[model samples]
Target: MGRKYLTLASALLLALCLNACGSRPGTVPPPSGGGEGEGSPLLTPASPDDCYWTAVRHESYNPSFDRTEVSTMPTEKWWADLYLNEDGTALFREVLGFGYASYLINVEWWLGADNVLRLTGEDYDGELVTMDGRMEKDRSVMLETPYGDRFYFEPAQKPDSGGALCIADLEGTWRMTGGEPGAGEKHMASLLNIERRWSDGEEGGYILRAEYYSARLLDTDTPQYETQKELLVEKREEALSDGFSGEPWSARLFSEESGAEYLAALTERNTLHLRRSDAPDGPQTVYTRSDSFLPETLTLTLADEPDDALIFYWRDPPAEVAQPLEALPMTALEKGGQNRILLVGRWYETDIQFCTGSAEQNADGTLGEWITDTVLYEGTLGIDEPQWFSLSIPEKNARLCLFMKRPWDESWFTWPITDQDPFLVSGNTFLTET
Candidate 1:
């Protein structure tokens, strides 16, 4: 994420910095040279290098239950991206809050007599921001800094050229196959998803999202305490996995909200190892590739207008995520009986809730509707097994039962209705209240 750590002057900047960026202060070797920055050294890199760092707190939306999942990444609270040119001139930048505010400076850097590294940069406003630090014992981290935050460097190399793993290679959902022994019987699994996403700001690239509990949370044995991270990742070689050979296509796994860093590498073609750098042999998590989880879509398009609607069928049931979509068209209809949008999906339920009503305005300037008497109001929920259920809408039709449904999808629009929540009926008597 080009997002940085800002916090220049006021509470506004503080709020911005807190939101825009954050860091995780662990001992993962900074991505530089091939691995540790110690040799080519963050203290002095002979060649120009690139790094992306973040200090962060974030949330992911779960549309199924209309919930917001909040998380504090267990990561360094402060970090910066550094570009050290051969000429001794370097650029330093940190984003705060949401990339809305930033602290970017150009400076001349050098190592001090006591082996301390120092940097002096002048921000755009002409304020000189000075930074100094000493290499920690492992030389894998820079511990003392102006921000009291440790720093690590990352390799800016892109695998696109090295004939190594490409950006497209990482897309899909991967779940850690097993849990640490004694963890629990909950079948605990960590998830890492890489999806190619496009947006005006990011144009088109890859978005990496990961879910893992923090050390503090894990210490409490609450594997359920989840910390989800969404990071903007590109061709970065964080470090070579302990037992893996060659540079593995990797992403920086820094959890600023959780204060831990896991160096994930492709241990094998479909196998991934999320090994902690400090404890190379420590209990690590491994993942196996899987298909991206796509909820079954049920589209309801207007019989005439371009207005379209969608109702998703989550197989995992209460599937904890909601893919965003445009507002469903409730006003795309007249008082006609046959002007229905089709009701369908790789429908798990043969009797999906089908509601229809004459489009009209309410007293509150909003629109609402009642269940219609149209010959299609049968609804059903599901399990993956092929089972049958009686269809009961418009009186009861025990003969109309759901078959073992499969091949989830629909063809044409038929049932015209505005998308609404599940309706309630008393005594199986259709409500005639308008």
Candidate 2:
């Protein structure tokens, strides 16, 4: 096999792999989960029935030296699955992307006279690779390569596969079941845990939220801070026909963090494939029914105030500015007109409780609610990188709060009822940030 082809296949396929755990480098561990006993099995002829042979042992010897070496050391590759059909067709699925993707290469195979198994396939770079295996009593196939390389084969316990799947079939929790997403540049927020409920919050739509960044950030340059993403996945009305499988269901996933939607597809084999809607050909992640869940860490960074929070008064407060707004007691909230959202330490029109929970952890570990001077109701999110402390003003109403948008400007005019939350000057009232 060409080194370049192998490198490309390995990078793109396993890049999205999950649970990327390993023992040591340059050491090939025994294949797990599918095959039976391991290491140099007793010789037997290959079975006539169609089956997949999981590569158990990969060994090679160089003939250049005076003494040739066989299997000097098997390389540790996450996936090298070989599928043989009774009809003489084969598939060599190489998975290298740490479980991110799989590249299926077409192969042709035939059992010649005396049970000689011949096979041919191409790598990612279209480099041709040929190997011949001898079936001992038709029980096992031992493949031999040019460098005296050998691959011990055993039947893979293929999972039961069904035809088309409905939304109900995939409503349960899903887990990532590939090799861990190793610390590579491409390891961006791999799926850790997923729960797909077939309800639209009010019992009509769909909601799929999952834990992300399941793969630990071994690489120092891992981008982003939040480890989990709250996704709003809804099933699409249209159905898609997949030639590789059968009729499959389609869905769309929305993320508040990225403010971008993703497309999800499902078919047989209990697998859910997710890819970005904009970059269809870009990186994708796969998930299967949850078995043993992988553990994930959460890192929360609470800003001093909401990203849209601002303090602008008709008259600028003293330069030292102690307490821009008075701390209105819970009872004082009744003084506001129409009783809109209330702010504990901030100003509000009707004094409504916009949200609950501690703005920041108290010194005694108690909880206290507080916010900034005022919040700008940004029309839509994902406009500017939102800060947890910065107030969110919808993009449409952004112009209303134009003075506040200037982060560098030290002084600005206060829009009062026109720009603040529960806009008193608005044609339509806005909902409180949950």
Candidate 3:
């Protein structure tokens, strides 16, 4: 009986070993070339002294939804290629499509360890391409600038979404309203309402888009306009979510009577005009200059007196702060009359590198930690608007940090600039106990 039990235990041990030896289905064994599995080539660790070269190409395509024929490059595949590529001394580029394929485009290039070259242009098929073998570097790659130099080919984490630079150019508030003129009336109220949406590229330029909302009246006390108003409201809400089916601009424009190209041209800023479809002698009207609705710019301010208070600034101030309130260092203020508190340093969230996986392994790839959703007005004040934050000061002595928030991002993060003293106020100055 003892021998029989021993035999059973041995058999179980053998079975277990065999199961361990068997390969699981769908699991690819590490590749022979030395990379562990088919992991992204871009993430392969670099040699100690060697600088790597690679890039994430963000190709923007503003394609319409219904048009099934239109195609776009997947973001994950492009990102994978950047990490999986075997060679580092090469230019990496990617192109992607967004929206209804009507609005924006972006192109990014990496020049080795520290140099990065970017170019942007509009039009779906605009003439834009950059390729030259001479630009390649077989040895070390570096870019020299007046202030300092950077290793162009090195890898630094970037944000998840793709966005345009010079978003700051889109600065300013645009009171946008939509509608066409009646037969006798020169202008009509906009059917769509506008909401502000700020997009920060990486961590720098901030751009705001006033999302237009179209509303039709529901049942109301006004009998004559009730039915039509309800339908209009339904249509406007549809426009907000689904947008214009084939061509968003048509539904977005003044009237269906307008030409397609004409409406397309209006997409450019301050160039819209009311013109007839045919005869040259037809009466015409133009909407330009101040007549055009534009975006508004929020104001920014910093601290007063002793400069040690300013350490960092972040875009998208934290929600914890009550806007227009100052962040003061409590203990520092009580001692030596040194109210070492910082305020009013305008900061914008550019990017975040979220480290994930087991902290023990440290091998798990860094997920995209950067955000491009909203521009934050960060400092040490609890001001709702950045402009208001700058204009107000704290009544007491306390050290606080402020930040803005956006809809697209998950949690708040700070930029390197914000981590450093960007707004430190001290000395006998105007910003004193008052």
Give the lDDT of residue 79 in candidate 3: 21
Can you give the TM-score per candidate against the true fold?
A: 0.30, 0.29, 0.20
lDDT of each: 0.37, 0.40, 0.25
TM-score of 3: 0.20
Order the candidates by lDDT, highest first — what do you get?
Answer: 2, 1, 3
- Residue 192's C-alpha lDDT in candidate 2? 38
Candidate 1 Cα errors over 4 Å, as ranges: 1-164, 182-186, 198-223, 234-240, 245-249, 255-260, 276-279, 295-434
CA RMSD per model (angstroms): 20.8, 21.3, 26.2
Reference-based TM-score, model 1: 0.30
Q: Write the per-residue lDDT of candidate 2 for residues 67-120, one digit (tens) a residue.
A: 544441123323345666644456654332112122224566654334456667
Question: What tens digits encode model 1's per-residue C-alpha lDDT throughout 254-320?
Answer: 6666666666666444666566657756776777775433223311211222212222222211222
Residue 273 CA displacement from its true place in model 2, Å: 7.5
Give me the candidate number with maximum lDDT: 2
Model 1 poorest ten-residue lDDT run: 322-331
lDDT (Cα, tens digit) per residue for candidate 3, span 1-434: 98676655544443332223221212322112232212211222233333223332222234575332322323422221121112212223222111121222332323211112222233224445432111122222232222221213334343222111111112222222333433544322221121223234452222222222211221221111100111110011111112222212221222323222112113334323222224233433333322122111212223322443222333334333312122111122112331222233223322222111211111353222233333333233322222222212233321233322332546654221112222223221122111
